[model samples]
Structure formats: C-alpha cells, structure tokens
Target chain A: MHKVVTVDMEKDILAENRRLADENRALLEEHDIRAFDFLGAIGSGKTLIIEKLVDHLKSKGKESAAIAGDVSGDDDYQRLVAHGIPAANISTGKECHLDAHLVDHALEDLPLDKIDYLFIENVGNLVCPVDFPLGSHVRVVVISVTEGDDMVRKHPAIFAFSDVIVINKIDLAEAMQVDPRILERDARRINPGAKIVKMDARHGNGLDDLISALGL
Target chain B: MHEFSVMSQIIEGLLEESKKWSAVKVEEVFLDLGDFTMLGEEQLKFSYEILSKDTILQGSTLTINHVKGTIECDCGFKGEMSPSEDSPHRIVPILECPKCRGPARIISGRECTIKNLRLVVPDV
Candidate 1:
C-alpha cells in the first residue's frame, strides 16, 4: 500500500538569515558595535590570536572582549576575566557550530556602547561554522602552514567564507618545508577578495598587518 | 557532526508542531540537505530514529532531499557540479562554462534547512 505525504515549511533558512542578519546589522549600526569572528580548525591558534588581539586593542585605548564557544568554554571565560576584559563562553553543549542566536545571547552581558571592538572565537571546526552566520562585520579564517599545503583545496568552504586568511606558525615554516606564499596564492585563487596574512604569533611577527586589516 | 544538533532542533520543532492539532500522527518530515554542509544521511536517519522515538514525533519517517551544487559562470552560464568520485578532490573543471568557458561562483550549497512537516490529523 502506498501512502501520501505532504509538508508545509514555515521558515526558509537563507531568507531568515538574510532577514535576521539585516536586523542585527541595523542594531549594530545604531549602537556602533564593530564585531569580527575568528574561525579556524583546532590548534590553529584562533584563541591565541584573539587573546593577543584583546591586548593589542587595549594598548590603543580601545576596549574589546571575546565570546568563546566550546563544550568547556568557561576556560576562555576565566582567561578573559583575569585579563580584566569582559567575556562569555557560549557553552554549545554538544553543538558543533555557533550561530547568530548564540552571539545574540552572548551580547546580553556586553556593554556594546563602551566597546570599540568585539571578537567571537567560534568553535574550532572548519565545516560547521561555514554554514552558520554570527552577524559579524568580518569573518577572519585562520590556517596554519603546518596543517598542510592542500588546506585551501580541502576546505574551500572555509577559504570562501573568509574575509581575511591568516597563515600562522610562520616561525616554523622553514623547518616544516611549508611555503606561506603558496597558501596565499591558493587562497587568492579560491577567494581573490580575501587578504592573506602570514604570522608567527609567538614571535610577534606580522602583527602590524593584522592590525591594519582590523582598521586599528 | 552538526547533523545530530540539527536533528535535535528538528525534533523540537516537530514536537511543538504536533501539539497544534489533536489526534495527528506525523507521516513524513521533509528536509533539504545542503551539499555544502557535512551532514551524513545515514547518521541523520539513525539519530532521528532514536531521537523521535516515544515522543510526540514517534515512529515518524525522515526524508531528506539533497540540493545540487550549482555554480554560475562569469560568462553567464550555470550548471550542477561534475566533480570526480574521489576524496580530497577540489571542485573542477574550475567553472569552465559549457558555452563561454569562464570562472563560476558557486550559487548554491550551504542550505541545510527543514523544508516541510507532514502530519495526518484524524478526521474529527
């Protein structure tokens, strides 16, 4: 016996995203809160870069904080508290991705008016975050040379999603036989519009280029 | 990995939807699985079967229709992808249009959405 099935979907995801993102952008414009999202794979130094970014922003008399998403996110929360920067951790529990709803929830604790910059360090995954929008002004995708030469080829979604690509761990590039230029070339091929930065955060190299990208 | 999380939301949506009408048993749930997304159908169905059991959405079937990846060429032609059956493969022939042969910007994929919910409310 064959049975008939029909369905009615009330909400369309992309349409809803376009609509809600417009609303979030409007609120941000009204309040003057400039936000950026740091997205990358695990061990790619997204957290380290964001942590350093907070200090760099503070040196210029700009206040900034971070929203770290994790299963045990409060580690970053504690670190932020110790640094005297306001922060929160969106404990996604089992969710691999962070979305605008999570960002909206994280903002409840922030003084959006007082801060000049806000950073959202999303969960460390290339695939999941590519699909979700955080309502950020910029999406900075970080890739380390040590990960491999084929990173851009394997993760087009991540590269295409990037407004800026940070090729980190350059200090080890020579020993690892990793060419950062190749990364930039491939990124250019994938997303010609994205600016690429080569950095060794531990050595404080290329920090100025990053700051320039942030317009600070 | 995100499939489980999305499935949870779908179940929640279904439960809330079922409460709107009395004596209705869900027949089918239609969903759009984006090609850009990394969800697995086997994982989705297995998890959904377990998640929907004994709740308001008990015994419901999940149907996922995969949306094709469409890229529009710089030369004004568009078509579905024809990537080879290989792992770690880049999407190629790099947007060469069948007509004008130019680069293509991917227009689709990244649309992991729950499109429909079908239920049979008993004739009252």
Candidate 2:
C-alpha cells in the first residue's frame, strides 16, 4: 500500500509511528531483552562500535543477534556473522531509517527465543532515525570528535534524545585536536543525564567501559 | 536529505487517502507544504522517484506550492519574509526594516507537510 504524510495529516501520521514505537518498547521490556540503539553521523565509527559490541558479547558467551538496517549492502551483517553472531540485514531499499514495522517484520524470520540480546544497528544517517523508534530499550548517540564540537548545537535532537552519549574516536582527540572537554560540556549541556562514554572504537579503547555501562 | 522520511509519509498518507476515495490510483499529489517548511524541490523529486516506485503513488505528479513565512515583531508590527539563505533563521526587525524603518514580525518557516492527493478512478 502507498502511504502519504500530507501536510494536513502529518500530525496523525507521526502520532501513529509514536504509538507503534511505544507498543514495541513495552514488548521489548516484556521479553527482558534490552534494546539499545546506536545513532551517529556518517563516519562516526558506529559500525565499528557495533562490531566490537558483538565481539564483546561473544567473548562473554552471550547469545546476541543483530538487525542491521542499511540503505545499501549487507556488509554489516556479514561482519557480525564472522564474529560468531547471527544478524539480519534489513535493506531499506530507499528509506533512510528503519521503523518498528520493518524491524518487527525482520524479527519474524529470526529465532527470537534463542537470542538473548537483539541489537538493532540503524542506518548511518543521524537526522531521520531520531524520529523513528525501532523498539530499542536504550538509545545511544555516538559522535566522532572529528565531526567538531559544534554538532551538539547543530543537531541538538540527537544529543537531547539520547539516553547515553558514546564519544567515539578519542584516540584522535589529539591528532585532530578534538577536545572531549568541550564536547562533554556541550553534550551534557543538552543532555545532562545521558551517560557519556569516551572511546576509540578502532583501538578497542573504552569498549569495555561501554559494555560495563550497558551492564553486559 | 529528510525528503525520504517526508516522502515515506506522503506515500503512506496517499495510501490512507486512497481508501477514502473509490479511485484505484492517484494521478497527482497536491502537496501544500507549510510556508515555513524548508523542503528542497530537487530532494522531494528525487525521493518521490525512488519511493513511489511500485506503489500507489507511482506515476503520480507532485504539485508543490511555496508559501511565505510569517513573522511578528515586538514593536506591534506583523509581516512575512523569506528565511535568510543558509541560515534559515530570522529575527524580528532587530530595529526596523531598512526601507520602511518599522519593526517586523515573523510568524512562519520550518513547516514540513503534504496537503492533499488527487486520485483517478477507473471508468467502467
């Protein structure tokens, strides 16, 4: 079916997505599976962090599967599978992000009962995904220090809506002269309550801290 | 950039409106985005071309109308103006219009919307 969000009906359309997201959130809680969302800019090391997360889970002998929704290839899924984790690639075709309905559809094809952790890696884009809730129990926004500290002011929604702030690429904080102190201030200024985890996903630095923060 | 989300909504909205009409397909999407909405024509066109494929909104033409942004000034003046380039921000005449020399008020911009869809029914 073709769906249109006309100007006159935009409110109703958004309300519907919100309602579905809430229901999905409740369902996740019922299953005792904490869903954590990883959102970030185009090259903010989100993919690497997600990959590290799968490995971390396996190192501890936990069962975790991923639902990677991308606009392009299934490289992310393969990356997870190579780590001894099962993953589902939800190719959006043309959409920038994934919604509850799409995630629900993909989950039907997976062994929901066998998996203890359901990690949904959203598309790399930051703007559209903010509005769509994919039933995640926690929403973490990852930012690369190279993207500039002003990102907090440029797109406050990502920082504001996030439950945890993962400051990736801390290793380049010196080479890139990216100051965590300023980003930290800006991040906290927008979302004072969100736990900020600084890390270099590529170097494996701070991954353990992130895992501990997630209580995994 | 955000057109895909808006287009996705437009597609969903069109499907929903189609149910109301006996029309089997839509001919044109009459979208009246709010004047305050900052939608690029090229982006919408691109998203529609891709998203409308194999859907009810396929082959449908999109008609867009640009409306003026509204502004209200503290000096008891109200008017409308286009958002500044790149900034997409505006301030009520900090003092007054350079020409009219009066405080200006802004009321709109930053609106994203799809107004209506025109559908065609099969002629039996």
Candidate 3:
C-alpha cells in the first residue's frame, strides 16, 4: 500500500543562493568596494568590455579586480591577469552559471581594501544567469551585434533584470546585418529606464559614457 | 541547463523528507512550477528521470502544476499577465501593465517546489 505524504516544503527554490549572495554583498560593503556582474553570451565580448573598463580605471589610478567564471577554462582568467592586476577564475565543471557560493569562495584571497571595483564575469550564457545574483552593485548584460537583433527580445528576462545593458561590437553592426536600434528598442521595452550603452570595446568607443553611467 | 542541478536539489530534499517516515519506495512527486521562471517542465522532468536512476526515486511519476505569473504595479495595477498565445515557449510576451503602461513588478509565479510525495512504507 502507498502512504501519500504531504510534504509542505514551502521553501523558495533559490533561497540558499540568495542568502549567499546577500552575504557576499555584506562583505563587499564592508570593504567599500563596488562590484558589477558582467553577463552575456559566449561571443558577446564580455571580456573585451572588461578589458576596456580595466584600462580606463588604470588611467584614473583606480585599482580593480576581476573574478572570471568559465565552464572549464582558464582562458578568461589569464586574459584578465595579462592586465597585471589581481584576478581569479572559478571553473564550473558543468554549470551554466556562477552562484554566490562560488563568488564567496573566490573572495577569500582578494585584497578587497585595495580594489576600487570588483567585476565578476559570469559564465557566458544568457538564460541561467537570470536568477543567480553574485552580489553586484550593478548587473550589466552585454549583447553584441553578431548575436543578432532578436537576442534581447528572445531573452527578455536578462534584459529586464540587468541594471545596465551594453550593446557591444557596434562597429560590426553593418557587416553582421544587425540594426543596433532594434536592440535598443527591445531593451527599452523590457526596461524603460535601463542605461543602454553602445560600445565598440576593441577601439574603446563609448567607454567614457559607460564609465560615467556607472559613475566609476 | 541548470535544471540538472535544480533536480538534484529536489531529490536531496525528497530523500531528507522521506527519512522521517522511513519510506521503502517512492511513487510520485508533485511540483508547483511558476511560469515566470522560464523553466521548461519537460527539461526538468527529463533531468529528474536521469538523476533518479539507481535511487529510491527511480521510476516514480512526476506531476507538475503550472502557476500563472502575477504582477503588481506601483501605479496600483494588479493582475496576471497571460502567457503568450502562440509561443510554445510560454514566455510572457509583455511585462508592462496594460492599464498604465508602466513596468509591473512580478509578485508571484517564481517558485519551484515539491508540493507532496507518495511513498510506500512497510507495515509494522
């Protein structure tokens, strides 16, 4: 005979993750460090924009550190290291997104006081990162022209949730046959007041505007 | 993609809960999934089936109840947004309030939880 049991979990599925994220936010607040989570698809130039931000911050004599999360590669971490600053990598073996627990562990060795800004580059995927918050003061989601115009519309959750939206690789819009305006309109519809930046990070275009928007 | 991890969490919870009654076999798992989370029910079930192998939960039936997305606006608008009619993806086509055209905050339909489980226990 089967004994049916009514297990009233009544628990939020993402509760643990959110609790860890809050802890990370508290730690960052203690050090007075501003953190941003860069989320985007794999080829959306997340690293390049970060490199530009690092360079811009360097010229201002501000120190910044990065935590790079990739599926199983040290490539992005090494690239940030090439900038000659403190950087670390969390290789999520099969996870599509980075959670607060991983970020909390990555923060154990960092010199938080010396860093002015902390950038957590989440594993490249638009969908899974929507619910995982890494305790960022600002959440920036990047979409490149190469990803096509429909990306923002198709993945509405990320665009709607991000604090800032970066449309990267604007220079390739013509070649990729993607109209940047379409993406901008879609983002606006999802989030009326979201700060949208059109960037060509390779040439450092629109970097200043982005910096001003972030107030960095 | 992260459904596997989520399914793993659900199974863990099931194991912990079943221990209280010393269940011998699991029969069915019922879930309440929200429409706003964009979680594919089929994918979640698939993940559950694959991860439950060799465990007590193996071969158990999975039942899901789709919860509708509800929202409230600062403008005093409160209602549920209908899931897209044509999109089999079940995405909420619009996120704004139809009454005021303002951004409506999602108030419900973001949970995925195990409502109950059917278990078989040995008669004393």
Which candidate leads in TM-score? 3
Runs of candidate 2 exceeding 4 Å displacement = A1-11, B11-124
DockQ of each: 0.35, 0.10, 0.47
* iRMSD (1 decimal) for each model: 4.9, 10.7, 2.6
lDDT of each: 0.75, 0.70, 0.85
Sequence-dependent TM-score of model 1 = 0.84
Looking at model 2 chain A, report the run of 10 residues with the lowest lDDT sum.
Answer: A4-13
lDDT of 3 by residue, B79-109 (tens): 8754444355656535566667677677777
Candidate 1 structure quality by residue, lDDT tens digits, A1-216 = 233345566544544544665666666767787888999888888877887888898888888878888765487677766767888889888778787777777887887788878888888888878767788889999889888877876777677667889999999889889788888876766565577889988778988899898776
Task: By lDDT, rank the candidates, best first.
Answer: 3, 1, 2
> In terms of DockQ, which candidate is strongest?
3
lDDT of 1 at A110: 81
lDDT of 2 at A202: 96
Model 3 CA lDDT for position A81: 87
> Per-residue lDDT of A1-216 in model 2, one digit per residue for the tens?
543333234333344666777777777666666677778876888778888887777777777878887898998778877877677889988888788888877777667666778788888876677656777888888898898866666765566567788988988889887788888876764455568899989989998889988877
lDDT of 3 at A114: 94
- The per-residue C-alpha lDDT of model 2 at residue A118 equals 78
